[model samples]
Target: MGCDGGTIPKRHELVKGPKKVEQVDKNAALIARWNYCAISQRPLRKPIVACELGRLYNKDVVIEYLLDTSPEKCIIETAAHIKNLKDVKELNLTDNPAWKGDKVNTKGDKYEDLQGAAFICPVVGLEMNGRQKFCYLRDCGCVFSERAMKEIKTEVCHKCGKPFKEDDVIILNGNKEEIADLQRKMEERKLKAKLLKKAKKSKAIESCVKSARTEANALSSSSSSTSTTGGKAEKPGKPVSGIAK
Candidate 1:
């Protein structure tokens, strides 16, 4: 039979084939991670903070999420790990001189460089764009490129001179393996803190019990001494009264 309007239908179109796999745009994903806040979905601003899992967020949004007791479900899921300001470190980012603000292409006629980053590594001067590996120090919140860290190894922060250990360095927007490692470290740290708190609480309870026992013993001893003294004193006075009768 002839097709409608004399249009020939291809065999591939008539017979359904296997569906093509949907792929995510790498550039868009990178922009989302590097340029936007994970919680509020707003553009990243100063006072940016990162969680233990290496998710970047604006400090104000994170604080708002923490303070809101009845937050939206998505906000809860996104920032549930952030209990307080202590859970996140405020990053000390260096401004990229070449990066014109996002307003540079407001007209939309000009070609915008997706790779332009607002911040860069203070140590190696590498842009904080998603192309390069970046890490922040938990101790001082100083950010540096992974290359600079490997090339110049030191116990103290390169930017702030604050001391930090190898464990204090947390990768920003890491891969699956790196994220899994970070999760494990986070769990271990939390477990250690919980155990320490429990130990301190037990110690305080033990001290209170010990003090209570000591006070009871002291009261009992004082009462026993007073009773013994009172029991021996009335015999002479009773004999004098009986002789007079």
Candidate 2:
């Protein structure tokens, strides 16, 4: 249709260009990864746990998933790697004093800080809000910022003072390469456990077989000694009878 009255029609109005691609917001993605459980998509709460791949989850949700006989496909896919409680470590997160968590804003006009984190690193005091890299010790489950770890090089956990090796340090919400490395470590740990179990089983079987052989030998020797004693006694008795006759 022609423009109303003396109005001119712009070329943009007549010709529509290609639609702009809708991109995901970086802040929203960070919030999703740091604040919410990877499996249930619920807000992370106390007694939070993380898997081998460094995905954070609520302990209760993971327990429910493990107990479920027929879990939803999404849940199964998200937590398929978690076989038992041992697969996840309960995070020891330090509470951020500045963070007012889900508190009802008495002043309705006050702006909410979505970037505020619930936890922080005890050492460097960096918020664990996905802005900075964080890691937890597998030996102690104490969380600390990556910066703190690098600055203070020690074998013990900064928060709990528990000794840990280089392999025990697992990065939280790590990148694809870090996740792959963690996966390899996980497989190696499982393999070592299996080999240890097998060795124990074989040792037990060997012990049982040795004990059985010892018992059998003892029985045979006892029976042979009794037969020999009986033969000697019978021979002596026969000789005495012949002499008396």
Candidate 3:
């Protein structure tokens, strides 16, 4: 596939199912890659399969709608519902009646579900984290806790190397687990980039080898033709002064 203008033309809609059925409600456009547990913590990614509910939900609030209904339910969903962290102007939770007040007031930032999420109520809400935050918890690599923002003097994304709200900090538990996950994601990206570079270099070398072979063959053919032409150009001329015939 090639790009005609600045953007690549829509080649084919990568649907989740083998056959596109009107009965099935799915994002008929874009490709998705991951499952999102929460709209607030949607990984910076797109999922290929949009849960059946996602089809019924509005395009803007598909994730939020899903989150509100069943944070626990792994509804078939696509990643396209998520917006990038940088695009977020504000980070607010849609009150999940089922999971609400599960963990409203806790010392640590770790909570099991929306009930736990509700426990840590955000006092002053703001979107300081970049657009990537909306994609997914993994991609955003953010660990700003709403509690940390309230306790700390500054609101900055410790992971992203930028300033964000203490109350708005996307809180991952302050534990070795969070740190390790961040490190692992970073390492994964570095490895992917390295592999891609290596592949490109290998391809270039193969192309060079092919070109060299082509040029060699062309020269051999041209030389043979030139030799035959020279021989013909010099007429036999009666065997060139044969020896004392």
Residue 217 Cα positional deviation in candidate 1, in Å, after optimal superposition: 2.0
Go through the candidates in order and give each one's C-alpha lDDT: 0.88, 0.89, 0.39
Per-residue lDDT for 125-213 in model 2, tens only? 99999999999998778999999999999988887788899999999999889999999999999999999999999999999999999
lDDT of candidate 2 vs native? 0.89
Put down candidate 3 lDDT per residue, 38-112, tens digits, no spaces.
233333222211221111112344535434545575544333433332222232222323443224456766533
Per-candidate total of colliding backbone pairs: 0, 0, 38
Ten consecutive residues with minimal summed lDDT in candidate 1?
235-244
Report how far off residue 201 is in candidate 1 (Å).
Answer: 0.4
Best-matching candidate per TM-score = 2
C-alpha RMSD for every candidate:
4.3, 3.8, 23.4
Question: Whose lDDT is higher: candidate 1's or candidate 2's?
Answer: 2
Candidate 2 at residue 235, lDDT?
35
Candidate 1 on 61-180: residue-level lDDT in tens?
A: 988787787645455565778888999999988999898765545567655455698899887899999899999998788899999999999999888899998989999999999999
* Predicted structure with the largest lDDT when compared to the true one: 2
Compute the lDDT of residue 35 as modeled in candidate 1: 88
Alpha-carbon TM-score of each model against the true structure: 0.83, 0.84, 0.30
TM-score of 1: 0.83
